[model samples]
Target: MSSALVRNPGDGTNFRYYTNVIEQVVSNAETGGLATVTRSIARPDQAPPLHTHSREDESWIILSGRVRFWVGSTSLDECDVHEAEPGAFVYGPRSVPHTYQAITSTAELLIICNPGAIEGYFHEAGAADTRSDASHSLMEEYGFVIHGNPPPAPQTY
Candidate 1:
């Protein structure tokens, strides 16, 4: 049995395990449940679209940099924004429509979700924009669908 939460990617294209440090980390996974902790570094122009999930609730804690998020009808801007430097925490319930954009070049955030939803979407589905129909067709079993937002631009590390 695997005791450590980290999963080594070895030489694969995926990110490294616990030692390399990832903003978005999947700490737990079971037959019907999982917990994901993400540490994300977002470029100033990077942002997700306005969308909602019917499956799981999310909680975010800003580790560094600045990020503005949309919750319901309210938008948190730079001026009146919530600064999550190191210890700040924010929770987002399911079915709430929201979007987020990075106001700074480097923004790190930790997103935690119960009964893991997005992780499966990212790992199993191959992300909506990155894969061809043949690759994504397998994900239909989990309630995955492409709705809002286009695929992210390809960048080299």
Candidate 2:
């Protein structure tokens, strides 16, 4: 059997991503301070709260299905959300409040983070009060600002 099948890179206690967001670090980030991997089984209608990081930048590549990404005040609906499917890629810079919502029933996305440890910001984003002012405060502390409007209605595939 492949060692990959028996090894666990992220366990609940050690990693924090949207429980709904399934991810695995195919390669160790410790070696070079970055992470690269293919993540699959992402469900539709799920989204991370609006937030950003001060220390890392994330690049997302789609393997299957579609993802709607929001940048700053412009939502995917307002500013041409990049529709990525196998071979499509989107890059988000550090300190920009953004969030993604799945459009297809099951979407697979590959996420690469430079300085890998920055995922802690993602963990924190998921923890913030997306509906309250507290969320905004946290976002600001990390150099992010939430958009005034919420995400747009889901787009049918």
TM-score of each: 0.62, 0.62
Q: On residues 1-157, what C-alpha lDDT tens digit does candidate 1 reach at each position?
A: 2465453323213443212234345543532466665565655445654555667787888877766666663332212334345566778777675666556567677767765755655554344354433554544554443345522432312
lDDT for position 147 in model 1: 41
Candidate 2: lDDT over CA atoms?
0.58
Residue 152 accuracy (lDDT) in model 1 = 41
**What does the lDDT read for residue 57 in candidate 1?**
81
Model 2: residues >4 Å from true position, as ranges?
Answer: 1-16, 27-29, 36-40, 74-80, 121-153
Q: Show where candidate 1 strays beyond 4 Å.
A: 1-24, 28-32, 73-86, 127-129, 132-157
Which lDDT tens digits does candidate 2 get at residues 1-157?
A: 1333333434312332545444555443433545534364556545655556666687888878877777754354444355667678888887666677678877777777665654545556552234233545745554545544545547657
| Alpha carbon lDDT at 62, candidate 2 | 81
